[model samples]
Target: MSDVDVIVIGSGPQGLAAATSLACEGLTVLVLEKADHLGGAVVSAEATLPGFVHDLYAMSMNLFVGSAFYEKHRVELQENGLEFVVSAHPYASAFPDGTSLKVSTDEGDTLKMWRAHSSADAEGWQRLGQLYDDFTQVYFPVYSSPLPSKSIASAFRGLWKVRATTPPAQLLQLVLSSTRSFGDRYFTTPEAKSLAAAWGMHLDFAPDIASGALFPLLELYGNMRSGMSIVKGGAGKLPAAMARMIEVRGGEVRVGAEVVQIQTDGRKATGVQLSNGEVIRAQRGILTTTPLPNLVNSLLSKQSVPSKMAEAARTYGFGPGTFMIHLALKGPIPWLDQELSDVCYVHLAPYVDDLARTYQQAVAGILPDEPLVVVGQPSVIDPSRVPNPNQHTAWLEVRAVPSEILGDAGGDLSEISWDEARDIFAERIIDKIERYAPGFREQILAQVAFSPVDLERVNPNLVGGDSVSGSHHQQQLFGFRPSWSLNRYATPVNGLFIAGAGTWPGAGVNCVSGPLAAERLLRDTHPSKRAFRRSR
Candidate 1:
């Protein structure tokens, strides 16, 4: 007899979403997590001090709470105790000149901030917001759904309506322009341009890359509409609630049950083998949430995946790793602009060119002198992160760090090893923060620095420590994600599927990949069920 109807391998947001969705569809689901604790990268831990909780990787739920999965299941999840907290100010960018640009939840306030910098950029922001509204109906659905999906036609229609008289090539170029190019066209101020450009680093997109404008634009639009949110107690609460939903719906979640291999026949996968030699068979199918490389190269034996397909999986481009630092502070960050203390999210990069150079340095295997930094002060919005009311917390991340450090971009440091580079880089990042937030270094009671290697060690899925799963460059995006063959979450081997950040819609806590995989699985395997879903 089969062990379960379906087996999900990994407990990341995507894996949890898929498992719960499948269980709600009345399938017997078993979720196996390699870690001792569940919630993969979304979980929070006391990395610095005993009472200070820190988000391991992803912190903001702007994407997660805004996702279709969350939208569909909000009531059910809220019933199970999923709480979120949001700030009035979305994010800010601080410059060396003691001037900063802020994005507020209130549009007029945001416009005023832009106006203070440049009236032309203020107009540009309004124009961009209007343009975003035109594309919202079409873009959101298409992005959160499978490619060659029904929503693609609607997107085309929306696009044509927006650019009725424009030539198709010009329209394509407009949509596919780089972040820097778009900034140049839209904004007059370097402040606005740099703010938008800095956002590209989140998706591993450099300034001049094609299709790079989307992230910055999307972040601005969404945060402008509804301010960014954080999980109430901790980031772990999200997936823990998902686990609860799955259990109440009659699914099982197992931690410390490491899946070592996929036992398969010549044509199809039969079941998974645990590290301890325990075998669990899947009656319906298997959703492999680990990276495709592990799935194709380790789990499945040779000849299971085609040679070329295996090569593609091996060559799957994982971009720059992030160096994360969490601090248990005595008080708030002392920003020169006191208004910044109220904001939770801050991007610290001098200019768009500086952000671009960081990416370039990362790809060239050099440590950035001034890495594109994101500092999140969740305790400002929700004080539960710290133990006492008197205490504060800071979450700092230096993005686009080379996974394998070949040299230091600053030329002040050498000895290219993350073990050595971790502290040195963290010091540099804190030094940058100290420049803007005087007394920043003094406020730190205790600090924990996690190198790219540290991230990889904790989560195997974050291979080489790339938080985005894979690079968001043109060659590996959209339909070409993971690989063209594995685009639809299906593999050559029957009953074996891949789903995760490596899939379409890429990474983030958005929970798109899992649900998309679930929908496709139902469409392909249970036609009657798909029809029923459609009818409903």
Candidate 2:
């Protein structure tokens, strides 16, 4: 007998969203989390000190704010004591030359900031800003909704109409072109180009990568419209909010419960067998997120997943790893650029070439001598991030490692000590930060580090600290994410499905994959209620 209508494995953003949506539909839902809490990597916190909330992984919810998932669920989250906050001026990237580029919700103000760096770039910046605003207004809704490619097509048409006023080919060039090559199309100056390059590199792809140009505009929208906000107290607030929502809707989230295997009846998934030997039954088993290989070799038996499927999963690559440093400072970081004081996020790369080198080094299994570090003072934006004014926290996220580096490229994460590696990474970051911000080393009251190894140990889905869930390459995106030519969320197994960052709409705190999975589940159980198209 089924105890619940659906059992969702993993309580990350996608899993949480899936569970919440299904629960709201009056379906009995049960969420299982390996960790003792919710939010997966999205809302994790590691205490480097007594009162500092070091975001274990992601530092901000900027991407989530760009999604309608947060908007639709904002009232519910706030009622549960979760408040999403943002800064007035979202992000600022600085060069050693002291020149900088800033963005804000106000398009005109953003133009002024860009103008300070280059008047020519200022015009291009204004145009791009308006284009981003238009794109967000039109495409963001379809992105938030669980709509298919037809909806994307419709949104593309709307984008075309808006871009028609500009050069006819500009829209196509921006969307389809490489950020490294096409980035120059928007800006002429070096600093302006560097800013755009760094923005696209957020996913860890180099500027020359195809469709990388599209990310800069998306990043701009997310940062300017909504500054990265920390959940009050810690990053875990987001997951807590999801758990509260689920409980209020008559669902339950069981933490410290590791799902060992998916029980299948040859043609369909019946339920899950926990690591501790508890067997829970459900009408539909929804695995909200997981890498393809683990889902095959670890969760399902050989018969359930064919050899061809396993082979395809084997060929799929996990993305780059992030070397993170969390600092509990004795005092606030004193920046040479006073304007940087209020900044929540900082990308410390002098040139586009530097950003490229960082990624190149990572692919080669080496960290750059000079890494691309994203530094943030969470306490400045959220008072509760620190225990007192005397105490402050800074998160330094660097891109320069691979998930498979720590162990035998194929062994499980148990083969390494991620915690120790994290300490080494923290030292390098403090040294780098001291370069621009003098006496920065003196302000350190406490410090903690997370290597790619540490990230994987903390969350198995992270897979060697590759935070974007899986590689965001073209073949791995859309319905092909986690694998090409497969409807990821809806697996071949009848009652089994996939979710999490490894699914479509690919990683980040964005809940598209989760909510989309829920919509698919709803459609699967009640096909006539909602319609969805399969990949063509």
Worst 10 residues of 1 by lDDT: 165-174
lDDT of each: 0.85, 0.74
**Local error of candidate 2 at residue 196 (angstroms):** 1.1
Expressed as tens digits, the lDDT of each residue in 374-446 for candidate 2 is: 8877788777777787778888888756554433221223334545445555666677778778889999887
Q: After aligning candidate 1 to the native by TM-score, how far in Å is the CA of 328 from where it should be?
A: 0.6
Clashing pairs in 1: none
Please give the RMSD to the true structure for each candidate, in Å.
Answer: 3.3, 4.3
Q: Which one is best on TM-score? A: 1
Across 1-536, the per-residue lDDT of candidate 1 in tens digits comes to: 24888899999999999998899899889999999988888989888888898887889898898888899999989988789999999899999888899889988888888888898998988888766676575577688777757778887887777675443454466469899998997898888899989888888888989889878888888887889899987898898899999998789999998998888877567789999889998866888788878777777787677776688788888888888999999999999888898887899987998988999998888889988889999989988889999788898888888889888978867756899778878899999999998889999999989998999888998878898888888788878888887788887776777788889888888889898788666556575754575699
Q: Backbone clashes in each candidate structure, one number apiece?
A: 0, 6
Quote each prediction's TM-score: 0.95, 0.91
